[model samples]
Target: MSKKQEPGAAGRATIRDVASAAKTGKTSVSRYLNGEKHLLSDDLKERIGRAISLLDYQPSQMARSLKSGQTRLVGLILADITNPYSVEVMRGVEAACRQEGLTLLVCNTNNELDQEKHYLQLLSSYRVDGIVVNAVGMREAAISTLQQANLPMVLIDRKVADFACDVIALNNVEATQMMTDHLLQNGFEALLFVTEPATVNTRLDRLRTFLQRMQQSPQCIAEQGEIELSNSQGLETLLRDFVARHPDKHKAVMCVNGALTLQVARAMRRLDMTWGPDIGLSGFDELVWADLAGVGITTFKQPTYDMGVAAIGQLVMRIQGNTEPVKDIEFSGELIARASTAAR
Candidate 1:
């Protein structure tokens, strides 16, 4: 009989023990277990399989990940988590990750490029499979670093001018054009475009589209044509002055996003300007209190949840080695006509 095996002395079986038991080299066992079967002979493969079964060997996931260089984890970097758009997008991303058996780690950059870069480097160091960025701007060096590491990434709700990556964003130009056309057809001659700043692509696109639409129409492109206001006081003063001067002309205002829309609404109320009778209002990114503000502000509703889900899907595909070329996906905004822009 063979020597009796000790009970407690038998430790966990490693790749070396498995190879020795199968009368093969450690490299063959490593290759076979890692699914690199082309390097092993059929006889050796059978022996390794038998040895693995007899020893009840289990591979260490940590060691396997170190060798394969894959974390099966995803990182999501949002510009601002407080924004409803970001929150909705995150919901979709989480859902997609759950379906794909991947983990999601979210970081809020608060719309800061430096913070975004820091998170990007941190995530890369942690060996995340990919990242989804929804920040305001992009830095070339930050993007190049990820590329150099062969890490997959996708942009959500924003786009970089030169960086070639998958992007999921809104159709800002079309939405703004549609909003402008609606206001024009409804007989609102004096229109104001209120926004935060024309820095990001979304803001710039909407402003350009609105200006272009106004330029084409001789009646709307007068000397006092489109009033572009940046701050709350400036916007309020401009609107108050416009109303005071052009009481005969139907006054209508368009806001770029939800935050600007809130400011516009407050200005209207503070200046004692009625919505339905005194002025007409419409804005983008329909907020929760949009309808509850007494005056129904007609606005464009973005598909926030769907955007998040699509961003995650694209990143997941990239992580899976589906690198054909960069793709840009745009989601259309829905036009909600309300009492604010009601025809009198």
Candidate 2:
């Protein structure tokens, strides 16, 4: 079936067309269109108005924004839009945008350095009032663009290491500390922290805090490891070896994010390992399946939606010309205790 074309997809009216129709120069048409009619005589206004009506001309918002310096658009660059954390953040950002009467434009980087640089440039080109960046890295190209970009940017959940900006993130130190203490209190003495590369601040903080807490627990056995989300076999092997090495010990695995949580859970299943009895499982982002999996996975539930709303609040204020010192806002998370971390 042939698809119908959108309105004005072909041969749409332009200011020049209106000007030609009205027997006036483009400046006169534009001035009239932009409500600078005082600069034009009554005859010019009438001719422009009649020509606009006859040609059904609609002015482009992009063109108007270029001249006015306000697009009423907020740009958002996300790491992975499909991540549960990102999805919640988006909901909050979208709701806040609606309340503030601004539109949202989003680009996903999928945690790729190249894509991050590309999307950063693309969003900057849009002339957004401000940006909410959940950035992956601050490599030279991205940092150069960020340094030169004048619009305000609010970072979410992760920091671009050296750049100073308002940051809205989970209290990683507090959350990870509390969760680690809980695991220790429950007697999960052998603990392994599984994550993707600790490249971003969130992972780095969590890994650091977990290691710190474990160090303080005199009897606790602690280890750190990384998993490639694409390498299920490697994850399974890592889990199997973790159990084999810590034989007869009460063991727990802490995943850094929801996507990794699911990956770890699946890898365990493939190895005929159930979380609660075979090993304790704890993670960061709370996903629905966390409670539905074999004996439910324990998670430190981040206030992702609230973080999103807060990011927009910060961005909107900056767009409104607030030049206060760069603020760091950290939201706290609650641990959802499930049987996944029950005494093993």
On lDDT, the leading prediction is 2
Instruction: Identify the leading candidate in terms of TM-score.
Output: 2
Worst 10 residues of 2 by lDDT: 1-10
Q: Please give the CA lDDT of all the candidate structures.
A: 0.81, 0.88
**Which residue pairs does candidate 1 place in steric collision?**
none
Alpha-carbon runs more than 4 Å astray in model 1: 1-64, 221-231
Model 1 lDDT, residue 190, Cα: 81
What's model 1's overall lDDT?
Answer: 0.81
The count of residue-pair clashes in candidate 2 stands at 0
**Runs off by more than 4 Å, candidate 2:** 1-60, 63-67
